[model samples]
Target: MLVFGPVRVIHCVAMITRVDTYLHSVPLSGAVAEQVGPFTLFRSTITWPYYARPVPGSEATITADDIELVRARCAELEIPLSFEWVVETCPSLGAAAAAAGLSVVEHPLLVLERDDFRPATADARLEILPTEDDVIRQARAAVNLAFGEGGTAVGTAGPAERDANAPAVADGLVATLRDRMLQGVSVAAGAFIDDGIVASGNHQPVDSTTEIVGVGTLPSMRRRGLGAAVTSTLVEHAFDHGVDLVLLSAESPAVAAVYERIGFHQIGHAGAAE
Candidate 1:
């Protein structure tokens, strides 16, 4: 068993700042980060565009007009206008986005300190996959199918669905993942059985902090603890590689509870509007 030290309020606030800064840096790496009013609009140089986020430490209240300006820029670029932010830190942006006719959703944001991780148990074997591994495509397909089904509950989807979709995984996406892994910016992990990858996830590291994203288990594989095990593998990998803080935003409280069982705790909420 692992024991977690009490986090001071001051320390927590400072960690939140680091998380915000790290989040801002990710989009800037692959997109053209432009300042539109009080928000930073991340215009994609590729097929998919990114969202606008409030500039860190900016006190200017986000207005409908500010949202419109970003909307206009997104329109010119032929991309959907969207926004994401830490709700506690950027409290006003959600309402402004909602008032601008975007649907807003709040997700539970959780964090795990190095000392807080507890290894989770599952029947499937968990491993950190190399960029060149052929199973990478299968893992991505499993993730896509898992997220498409959309929930923590077990359903009909399984290995058959995963295999059928594996070949359709975009070559560009696989290439991007490989390039990012080679650059030491991202790491991918999976929980596997003989059939193939049952659960998959990735972590993007920036300095001493990393955020786990896109973790999902095939619907038929749910309730077997694969999601938690995969998350633990990623978190352990991050800590072993010098990351001190691991963060992830869960789709809901129920989803957050899976991470909580492995020692993550809610620190805040992440807001998204589209």
Candidate 2:
């Protein structure tokens, strides 16, 4: 069964609409968005691929046939067939995707309005990194390690593990991140100690809206509030830079609670299928 957040009622419908529109627009900068049936297929023009999303405000019922059409298009393009949507807004798509034999996961979706921003504390120094900074690779490496291990609980991977993986971090990814930063579409930040970055994340701004993503703390460094601190820095940076809304999808409810501590509230659930 696919579970979602508590924003499925009528009162939160407008927010859900706004979020759907924002998400549909975000990938346009780097992907060619094609309207296939009731879905918008974002075909990547860059190294990282994008996913299909339901057309905002479309009330068309999502049948397995619609999913199949999108899947065929993805296959023709040699890209994986995947979908992401705000479950509250596109309530029917999740079941359709699942019926089409895709594995789906529901993420706790959250957002922070400018007025709700709350700063968090961290023992290490935190700062936004410049595009040309060499530390960006290490930061990216740390994030990969964090996600690879997955979850909010503490584990063994940390600075040493990140260092071991940094050299293997693809230059193309680093280049892409730098290019996005240079274009004013993204900003990267990290929590640092003498050993190096222990947690890293970035926010991608599209006009007055931004999504804080890729936030991860080194596994061994978990439970120290570094992830929250990095997220706080990103949120503050986004607000200071004219972003009015900040959004993110956590890996689980426990992880979502971490964001809740710093003032984000659950708005919906982000569903993904592949």
Candidate 3:
């Protein structure tokens, strides 16, 4: 069920290089692009609401014409323009992106691998399950509740109320999740207890690496090791499917600590805006 690859741990710098190469490989669908000065511009359905950026260090200058070209392409697609810049490489792109009227969303993003991954202890007693059938429904509810998608508090009634008032929206979101799971666009795992899902996470695979995303534990369920279980389980799944490396971004130092406990090491920071 898996391909064989000699397992060798990768360093932070090499990992960043691989990430840049990965971006250029992303298939651009039904979109045209051109090189404006040192930067590259491409439009694609998969990268909706944003134009694509070349790998960091590959470009150095951004001209007014470059921004206008991006604007023109975005306008043609009837979507807004956006750019992603990794500070380690593209120091000038941030100012350029800002000048283009793109509101920058900057944060410290940590990268980790399985070598640094700390496994959850067995005594946690949480049943981590693959997202399938009804598990998808429960996992969807768990993610929304844990992430406070419908309200400021994790356990608030907003998610439930929204489900009740807008059944279609909720159902649509869950259905899309299901499709993504089935299509391998994402692999989801959920930790379930007596009540329902308490923790959930996803792995987004691109080429040789899989990105751990949406690793959230319900507020009430935190401090019990459920988050570690969800993350470890997803990492295992990605490896089983032949992914050589796994990466994720922590929202802050505190959150990064939680991931570090599970063997993920901080590599670098990334910037993006939409």
List the candidate numbers ranked by lDDT, top first. Answer: 2, 1, 3
* Alpha-carbon lDDT, every model: 0.88, 0.89, 0.63
Candidate 1 ranges beyond 4 A from true positions = 1-7
lDDT, candidate 1, 1-274, per-residue tens: 5544666767777877878888998876568988988999898765356899999877678888999999998889788889999887889888898899999999998999977888897998899988874678898899999999998999888999999999999888888777778888779999989958999999998888899999999999899999999999999999999999999999999999999999999878899999
Candidate 3, run of 10 with poorest lDDT: 150-159
Q: Across residues 94-199, which tens digit of lDDT does each residue of candidate 3 receive?
A: 6667777777766555555556556775234344455455666666556655666422223543334423433333565566666666767778877766545667
| Full ranking by TM-score | 2, 1, 3
TM per prediction? 0.94, 0.95, 0.75
lDDT of 2 by residue, 1-274 (tens): 5555666455367676777788999898789989999999999987798999988878778999999999999889899899999998888998999999999999999988877778998999999988863688899989999999899989999889998999897888788888888998789999998859999999988888889899999999999999999999999999999988899999999999999999999878999999
Pairs that collide in candidate 2 are none
Model 2 ranges with Cα > 4 A deviation: 1-11
**Candidate 3 wrongly placed segments (more than 4 Å):** 1-11, 23-51, 55-57, 63-65, 121-133, 149-169
